[model samples]
Target chain A: MNAPILWIAVPFLVGGGILFLLRERYAAWLGGGTAALLALIALVIPIDTALLLGPVSLKIAPSIQILGRSFELNTADGPLLAIIYGLAALWLFGTEASGTANRFVSLGLMIVALLTASIAVEPFLYAALLLEMAAMLVVPMLVPPDQKAGRGVVRFLIYQTFAMPFILFSGWMLAGVEASPGDLGTTIQAGVMLSLGFAFLFAIFPLYNWVPLLMEEASPYATGFLLWALPTFTTIFALDFLDRYTWLRTTPQLTNAIRFAGVFMVASGGIFASLQRHIGRILGYAAITEAGLLLLIIGLGSSEIINLTFLILIPRGLELVVWALAIAIIKGRIQSLRFADVQGLARSYPVAVSSLILAHLAMSGFPLLAGFPSRFALWQQIAEGSLALSFWVFLGMFGLLIAAIRTLAVFVMAKEDAKWEWNESWVQTIMLGLGVIGLFILGLFPQALQPFLSNLAPLFEHLGQ
Target chain B: MVTDTVSWIAVGLALITSTAILISRDWRVSLGALAVQYLAAFWLVTRHLPLAMGSVKLIAGWMVIATLGMTRLSLMNLEQQEEDAFFPRGQWFRIALMGIVVLVAAGSAPRIEAAIPGLGLPIIAGSLLLIGGGVAHLGITSDLLRVILGLLTMLAGFEILYAAVESAILVTGLLAAVNLGLGILGSYLLIAGSSPLENEDEL
Candidate 1:
C-alpha cells in the first residue's frame, strides 16, 4: 500500500462517489466518518515502515510514481494529515447544521484530498495545478443552488486562476537558478515570479476584496469554510516553497517581505473589520487578520515556525467554525447581517450571539481565549524583530477588539425590560457550546495540543532548522 | 524556413484572435476568436512537442469552447441576449490595451528568448499576446462568459510556453483537465447567473 493512494486517491474517489451516489441525509455521517477514519489511520499508521498487526505484517510505501511523476508522503506527514482530516471531520459534522450538507460533504473531502496530493506531488510545481483544481471545486460549493452567481465568486475564480501561471513559470525559472546559483538576474526574476504567485494566491491585503464580498453574498457557513480551508492549505503550500528552496530560506529579504505582508494583512484586515457594520464582513476581515497571523508564524525564525503554524491552525479552525456557525444560525433568524438589522439580537438568540461575540474576541486574540497564546508568541517575535512592526500588529489586534465591542453593543442593544430567549436549536446550542468550551480549554490549558504540534515540527524537514 | 513562417503566422493569428475576443460584442464571435486562438496555440506548441501531444491543447481548448457554447445556448431563451453595439463599451480602451500588449510582447520576446535558452521568440511573443489579451479581457469585463473566455485564453497562452519547458504527459493532461474544469465552471456560472434574482437588492 502506498501513502498517496491511501490518503490522496482513496479519498478523492470516495468523495467523488459520494458526490454522485450518496443521499444528502447520509452524506455528513458517511463522509465525516470517512474523514475521521482517515485521520485516525494517519495518526496510527507509519508510512514506509513495517508494522505487525496481529498475524500480518504491513508496510505502507512512502512514494508512488505515476506517468513519470512521483507523489510522496513520509512519516512526518502523519500529524499534519491527521490535523487536516480531523479539521475536515469537525466541519463536516456541522454540514447539516449549516444547511450545506449536499455538496459540502463531497466537495470538502475532495478539496482536502486534492490539497494533500498537491503537497505530495513531486516536481512539486505540479502542486499549483492541484491547488487550482481544489479552488475550482470550491466554486460549486460556494454558489447558491438557485441564486445567481455573485461577483465575488467570479473574482475568486479569476484571481485564483491567475496564480497558477505565475507559479508554474516561477518553477521553470527556478530550474535555471538551480543550475547557476550565482546568476543574480535569474534569482531576482524567479523570486519575483514566486512572490507574485503567492500574492495572488493569498489575496494579500487589497486583493482580498473578494473575501468580504463573498461573505456578503454567500452563506457565512460555506464562505467561512472557504475562508478557513483555502488559506490553511495555501499557507502550507507557501511554507513548502520555503522548505524546498535553500535560497528562499536563506534569504533575509524574502523573510522580511513575508513579515511585511503578515503585518499589513493583520493591521488592514482588523481595521476594516472594526469599521464594518455588517457582521459577515467583519468575520471576513477577522479571518484576514487570522490568515495574517499564519504568515507571521511563517516569517518568524524557522526553528519553531512549523510548530507554531500548526499550533495556531487548530484554534483558527475552531474560531471560524463557531463564528460561521453562529452567523449561520442568526442569519437563519434574520434577513440581513447588518448590525442595524440585528440590533438586540441577543434578546432573540442569546447562545448564537454569545458564540459569535466569543469567536470574534478569540479571533482577535483576546486573552483567555484560544487565540491568545499564538498572538503572544507572534507579539514576542515581532517585538524582537521590530517594534514598529510589533505596534502595527498590536494596532490590528486593537481594531479587532473595537469590532468585538461594536458587535457586542449591537447584540445587547435591547431594553433592560426585554426578555432573553433560547431560540437556537438544541443541536446548534450543543455544538456552539462545545466549540466555545473547546476554545477555553485550549486557551486555558494550551498544552492539550502539544503532542500533535511536537509531532508536526518534523513535517517540513528543512524549515525546522 | 517553413517552420519560421508558421511560427510567425501563429503569433500573428494569436494576437488578432485574442484582440477579437476582447473587442467583439457577441459571445459567439468572442468564442470563435478563442477557438482560433487555440489553433494558434496548438501550432506553436507543436514547435517543441509531438503532434499527438500538442493536439491535446487544440482539442481541449475546442471542447472548452463547445461546452461553454452549449451552456450559453441552453441559457439563450432564459437570458435577454445582448446585441451588438455601434460602439461597444470600453472598445477604444481595449484596443489601446491590446496595442500596448502587442508592443510589450514584441519588445520582450527576444529578451525572454535570450534569457531562457531553448525557447523560440515567436512562440514567446504569441504566448505573451494571449496572456496579455486575456488579462485585458478580465480587467475590462465582468460578464460571466467573457471572464471564462479570458481565463481560457490566458491558460492556453501559459500552456504554450509551458509545453516548451516541461513535456511530461501528466503535466499536459493535468493542464488540459484544468482548462475543461474552468470551462465547465464558467458554463455553470452562466446558467446559474441567468436566473434572475427575485429582488435587485437581494444578496
Candidate 2:
C-alpha cells in the first residue's frame, strides 16, 4: 500500500461516502473516528520502511503516481501527519458539541485530506492548486444551506482564487531559478511573487479584513476551525519554502523582510483586535495575531524555532476550539456576539464565558497558560535580536490582553442580584472543560506534545540552523 | 499570416467580450459574453498549446457558464429583474475603469512580454485586459452572482497567461477543474442564498 493513498485518497473517498450515506448524528463520530484512526496509523507506522507483524511483512511505499504526478511522503513526514490528523481529530470531535456536525465533520475530513495532498504532491506547485480546492471546500461549510452567502464568504473565495495564479507563476519562476542558479533577476522576481502570493494566502496584515468579517457572518465555530486548519497547514507550507531554498532562508534581506512582515502583522493585528467591539471580531483579530506569531517564529528560521512553533501551534488549536465553542454556546442563546449583547453572560453561562475569557487570555499570552510559554520563549528570543521589535510584539500581545480585559468586564457586568449558573449543554460543558484542561496541561507542561511533533524538523532538508 | 490575424482578432474579441461582461446589466448578456470570452481564451491559448489542448479551457469555461446559467435560470424568477438600463448605476464609472485598464494593458504588455520572453504581445495584452476587467468587475459589484462572474473572468485571463508559460497537460486539467469547481460553488451559493427568497415568494 502506498502511504499517500492510505492517508490522502482513502480519507477523501471515505469523507465523500459519509457525506452521502450518513446522517449528522453519525457524521461527527464517523469523521472524528476516522481522523483518530488515521492519526494512530501515522503515529505507529513509518513511511518508506518495512514493518513485520506476526509472520507477515508489509511496506507502505512513500509515493503514488496518478496521471503523471506523484504524491510522496518521507519517514520524517509521519510525525507531521500524526500531529495534523490528531489536531484535526480534536476539531472534528468538537463539532458535535459546537452544533456544526453535519458539514463540519464530513467536509472537514475532505479538507484535511486535501491539505495533506498539498504537502505530499511533487513539484509542489500543484500544492497551490490543491490549497485552492481546499479553500473553496471551506465555503460550503461556512455558509450553511439556510444562510445567504455573505461578502466575507465571497471575498474569501476571491482572495483565494487571486492567490493561486501568483503562487503558480512564482512556482514556474522558481523552476527557472533552479535551472539557472546565477540568474539574479529571475530569483528576485520569484521571491517577490512568492511574497505577494503568500500575502494573500496568509491574509497578512491589510488583506485580513475578511477574517473579522467572516467571523461576524459565519458561525464562530466554523470560522475558528477554518482559522485553525488553514494557518496550521499554511505555516508548515511556508516553513517548507524556507527549508527548500537556501536563498529564501539565508538572504539577510529576505529574512529581515519576512521578520518585519511578521512583526508588523502582529503589531497591527493586535491594535485592531483591541479596538473591536464584537467578540467574534475580537476572536478574528486574535487568530490573525496567532497567524502573525507563526510567521514570526518561522522567520526566526531555525530547526529549534520550528520545534518551538509546534508548541505555539498545538495550543493554538485548543485555544481556538475553546474560544469558538464558547462563543457558539453563548450565541445559541443570544442574538449577536457583540459585547453589549453578551454583557452579563457570565452570570447566566459562567462556564461558557469563563472558557471564552480563558482562551482569550491564553491567546493574549498571559503567564501560566498554554499560549504563554511558547510566546514567552519567542519574546526572549526576539528581545535578544531587537528590543524594539520585541516591544512592538509585546504591544500586540498587550492589545490582546486589553481585549481580554474588556471582554471580561463585559461578561461580568451582570445585575447585582444575578447569580452565576451553568447554562452549557452537558456536551458543551464537557467539551469546553476538556479543552480548558488541555490548555492548563500544556501551559504547565509545555513540552508534553513534543513527542507528536518531535521529528518534524527532519522533514525539511536544509531548514536547520 | 492568416493565423496571426485570427489571433489578434481573438485578442480584440477577448477585450470586447470581457468589457461586455463587465458593463452588461443583464445576467444573460454577461453569460453570453462569457461564452464568447471563452472562444477568445481558446484562440489565445492556442499560441502555446495544440488546438485539442486549447479547447480544454473553452470546454471548462462553457461548462462553468452552463452550470451558472442553469442555476440562475432557475432562480431568476426569485429575484425581481429590474428594467434594463442602457448603463446601470455606476455603469459609466465601470466604463472609465475599463478605459484605464485598456491603456494599462497596452502600456504594460510589452514590458511583460520582454520579461517573460516568448509570449507574444497579443497574449500578454489580452491577459492584462481580462485581469483588469475582472478586478474592476469584482470591485464594483456587491451581488454574489456578479462577484462570481468577476472571479471566473479573472481566472480565464490567468489561464491564458499560464498556458503560455507552462503547457503541461496536468496543469491544463487542474485549471479546468478549478474552473468547474468555481462554477459549482457559485451555483451552489446562488441557489442556497435564493432559497429563502424562494420560500418567501411562495408565501
Candidate 3:
C-alpha cells in the first residue's frame, strides 16, 4: 500500500492495539494527534498508487480484487480520498477532548479506510461489504457502555444492515449482466436494486429514523461526525455509481426522483430541527437537510454540482469543529438548548457565541457566509425554468434558514435567569475566530477556490457522463 | 426453478420463524425462535457453501446474541423479571408487523430469471430471512442489545446476498475489522449503563 494509505490506517491500528496499553489520557491524545498529522499529510500528497500484494496494488489507478471481483480507481478518486481522509483526521482532533476519543479515532480511520476501498473495489459487492463495515465500525463511536444501550444504536445498525441487501443484490445483477451477453433484463434489475440500495444506505425518507434515534443517545461530537462524514462519503460513492453507469445520468426521471428526495429531506429536516430541544440533534437534522441538498445537486447532473458539493462539505466541517468545541466547553451542564437556556450565554462567552452564530449562518446558507455562494448557485440552477424543482429546493433552503433562525432566537433573543460570564481559553477563541474568517473568505472570494473545484470537476464529470 | 423452489422454502421458513420470535409473548420462546432462525441461516449458507463463507460469520454473530440474551436473562433480578418490560406485547406486535412487511417487500421484488452460478435459491432466501430478522429486531426490541442483534442479523442477510455476487476476499477481511468494532461497541454499551429514562423528544 502507498504511504498515504498507511498514514490513514496506522492511527486506527495503533489506537485499537494500545487502547488499554497506555493510560487513558495519553492514549487518546496520541491517537488523535496521529490522526490529525496523517490527515495533514494526506492533504499535501499527490494521489499515487503502489503495490501492496501482487496485482492488488494501491495506485491512483490500479485494479483491486474484493470478494472475487475486480475494481480500479481512476484519477478522480484522489480528491475524494483526500477529502474523506482529511475531514476524518480533523474530526479525530475533536475526539482528543471527549470521552470516546480513542474508539472514535480507531473507528474513524477504519471507516476512512473502508470508504477508500469502497471507491476502488469493484463488482459493487466489495463496495457493499465496505459500506456495511463502515456502519458497523460506528458502533464503537456511538454506543459506549455506562449509557444504557437504548433502541437508537440498534436501530441505526438495523437500518444500515437492511439497506445492505439492495446493494448486494444489485451487485449480483450487475455481475450477471457482465457474464451474459447484452441482457437488458438484468440491467433493469440492477438499476432498480441500485436505486433502492442507495436509498436504504443513505437513510432516505422513512428509513431515516436511525439518525435522530442514534443522536438521542450518542455524544453530540460523535453524532456530528457521523452526520457529516457518513452521508457525505455515501453521496460521493453514489456519484461514483452514476459516473460508472452513464445511462443512469441520462434518465431524467431518476434524476428528478433524486432531486425530489433531496428537497423532501431538507424541508423535513429543517422543520424537525426547528422543533428539537437538544442542540446536538439540531446539528444532526441540519446535516440531514444538507445531505438532501447535495442529492438534489447530483440529480441535476452538472459538473458544477460536484464542485458545489465539495464547497458545501468543506465549510460544514467548520460547523462540526465549532459545535464540538462548544459542547466540550459547556461539558453537558446546560439543561436545554431551547432559546431560553442559551439566553445570556453570549454575554458570558462572546467569542464562542459569535462563532456559533456565524457557523449557524453559514450552515443556513445565509448570505456572506460560506454556504451562501453554493446555495445561491444551486438555487439559481433549480429555478431555471423548472418551477417544481425550484419550489422544492427553495422550500428546503427555507427550512434550514428557519432552523437557524430559531437557534438564533434561543441564544440571541431569549431572556436568561442568571448573570452571564465568559471563561473559555484563548486557544478556543482563536479557533472560532479562524473558523469565522474561513467562512467569510470562502463566501467573499468564491473565485479563489474556483480553480480547485474546477480541477476536481473532470473526475466527477467523466464518471457521471 | 429448482433453485427458486429451495430458496422460497428456505426464505418462507426463515420468515415464519422470524415472525414467531417477533410475536412470541415469552422471552424464552423468543430466544428459542431466534435459535431456529439462526439454524436456518446456517443451513442456507451450506446450500451455497462455495459462494458463502458468510455462514461462519452468521453463526459467530448469533452466538454473541445468544450469550448476551442468556446473560441478561440470568442477571435480571426477580423484581425486574416481574416487570412488564423486556417482553412487551405491544412491542412484540410491532416486531411481527415489521417482519411481515419485510417478507412481503422482499418477496414482492421482481425475481431474477435465473440464479447466478454458485448462488442458488437457498442463499437468496437465507439473505431475505436475515433482512426480516433485522426488521423484527428494530421493531420488537427497545433494549440496546436486542437492537444490535437486529442490526447484526440485517448485516448477515446482506452478507449472504453479497455472496451470490463477487467474492472479494479483501473486502471480507476488511469487514472482519468492522465486526470486531461491533463487538467492542456492544461491550461498551453494556458497560455504559442507560441514563434515567427520558420522555424528551430528540432533535
Best by lDDT: 1
Q: What is the lDDT of residue A269 in candidate 1?
A: 92
Q: Which residue window of length 10 is worst by lDDT in model 2 chain A? A: A299-308
Which ranking of candidates, highest TM-score first? Answer: 1, 2, 3
Q: What tens digits encode model 2's per-residue C-alpha lDDT throughout A51-130?
A: 89989998989998876888898899999888889888888888888877577887899999999999998877778898
- For model 1, the superposed segments whose C-alpha errors exceed 4 Å read B77-87, B193-203
The better candidate by lDDT, 1 or 2, is 1
Top candidate by DockQ: 1
User: lDDT by residue for model 1 over B1-203, one digit each (tens)?
Assistant: 99999999999999999989988877788889888899999999999899999998889989999999998887766444454322246778889999999999989988999988778988899999998998988887777788898899889889889999989988988999999999999887777756666853222
Once superposed on the true structure, which residue ranges of model 2 sit more than 4 Å away at CA? B78-87, B197-203
Model 1 alpha-carbon miss at residue A435, Å: 1.1
Tell me how candidate 3 scores on lDDT.
Answer: 0.64
Clashing pairs in 2: none
- Ten contiguous residues with the weakest lDDT in model 1 chain A: A94-103
Return the lDDT, model 2, position B201.
Answer: 18
Chain B TM per candidate, please?
0.91, 0.91, 0.67
Candidate 3 iRMSD in angstroms = 5.6
- Using DockQ as the yardstick, the better of models 1 and 2 is 1
Docking quality (DockQ) for each candidate? 0.54, 0.51, 0.43
